[model samples]
Target: MKRRATALATLLLTGAGLGMLTVPAEAAPAAPTRTTAVCPTGWGSTQKTGTSAATASLVNIRTGRHDCFDRMVFHVPGVGSSKIGYRVGYVSRLYQDGSGNHIPVAGGAVLEVRVAAPGYDPDTGKATYAGKVNKPLPGVNLTGYRTFKDTRFAGSFEGDTQIGIGVRARLPFRVLQLPDRLVVDVAHTWGTAR
Candidate 1:
């Protein structure tokens, strides 16, 4: 009986040792590295080349929301591949489009967008864009945006048209020139500047 008891104890110890040496069926993968989108670079105050004789007429103005930034597009029609010159920067105050009167916009900072193209048809001497030339242009709506607060038409004069954009703060912005449009995108945060 003592021999039998000793044999059983030896068997139990060997089983326990084997169990510790067994490999797991699978090991959990190392936690995936967190990834983030790479923001665009060089989007601060910028200017592009355009022509003074270009006859691009402003047709529309609109805004869109993005994951990283807010966008504003100024559409000009009937101008081929001509580049529209523009200046985008923060301003102390927003002035009326044509009258140069102080216009109040709701935001922490105001961006002045000036396009080289006019908002009128030179042939007919009539306004090409039918929106309000004053504060609160008819179609631009900024209801649930994070950066944009308000938009106002600053007016068109001497072959240049201006629009006032109210943002949460003075953030990094980029300008893009398409065949028929000019695009402005403002970063939601200064840290996320591309």
Candidate 2:
């Protein structure tokens, strides 16, 4: 009887009225909060270039928006990994490769993305990436992108394909060469650089 009473007393003492029942700090539920996306460091805004020959044709273009960056990809279907090369740099204006025509793009800054490959099949003499040159890339809707404002196919000539990317501002970016894929990522802001 005494043990039962002592147990009852202990339970009551740890109840709501006594304010003794508690959860460990680490076990407590986290309060809801907003946070910015984290990003890697060390990427810069300087011009980046690599040497490559037209071993394969550029076949497609793709783009995506992430919390920290915006990505653009060039697809060269027949090329091996790291076979694709690029020259990415900020330019005052974007110009066509063959015609030298000035192509106006939206945004505060323009990045000239050059892939060292043709956008046409050499043997068949057929266009691989059928999108019109010097036109805003068809079907690319940058309506809600944090950094990208516009994208255009500058031109493709002499074993090179040029893309013009209009970004909100001059921001850091990085390039990745994968099998048949040349990926470029532009940070949403300076804080998200690299």
Candidate 3:
């Protein structure tokens, strides 16, 4: 009986040792690797001119956010395939549409956008955009944006319309004229300048 008990103890010790030496069938997965791409620099001085007059009228304005930049879009109807010319740049101040009064904007820098389109309906002689045509226009929300601070309708006169954009700083920007819209994208930084 004593010998049998000693043998049983030896067998239990061997089993425990073998269990410790055994390897797991599967190992935990490695932590995921993260990577981010570098964005381009030197986005500056964008301009485009259309061959024909703009047939559409400016009706609305909107803004959007991107990983590298913030965008503002000028909504126009009936633009279709026609060309629309524009000039956009940083300016000293923004002026009101018809009164020519200096309008105050909230930002470290200002951008002046001039579009070769009308903000009024030619047939009815009414403002195409239902929003306020002056400073403090309604529905231009600039929340949680990195570059844009504020935007205002500067004026619309003689088949041309203007807008003022307030930015965090004098950053790089580009302009795009789409089939029915004009888009302005302001970079978050000037390459390594940020």
Which candidate achieves the best TM-score against the true structure? Answer: 2
lDDT winner: 2
Q: Mind sharing the TM-score for model 2?
A: 0.80
lDDT values for all models: 0.80, 0.85, 0.78
Worst 10 residues of 1 by lDDT: 45-54
Q: How many residue pairs clash in each candidate?
A: 4, 0, 2
lDDT of 1 by residue, 74-111 (tens): 88886656777787788889776557688787799988
Each candidate's TM vs. the true structure? 0.75, 0.80, 0.75
Q: What is the model-wide C-alpha lDDT for candidate 3? A: 0.78
By the TM-score metric, which is better: model 2 or model 3?
Answer: 2
User: Which residue runs of candidate 2 sit more than 4 Å off their true CA positions?
Assistant: 1-30, 192-194
lDDT of 2 at 47: 98
lDDT of 2 by residue, 58-131 (tens): 88888898878999888898777656778999999998887889999889999999998888887887988877
Segments of candidate 1 deviating more than 4 angstroms? 1-35, 46-53
Q: Which whole-number lDDT from 0 to 100 does residue 1 have in model 2?
A: 100
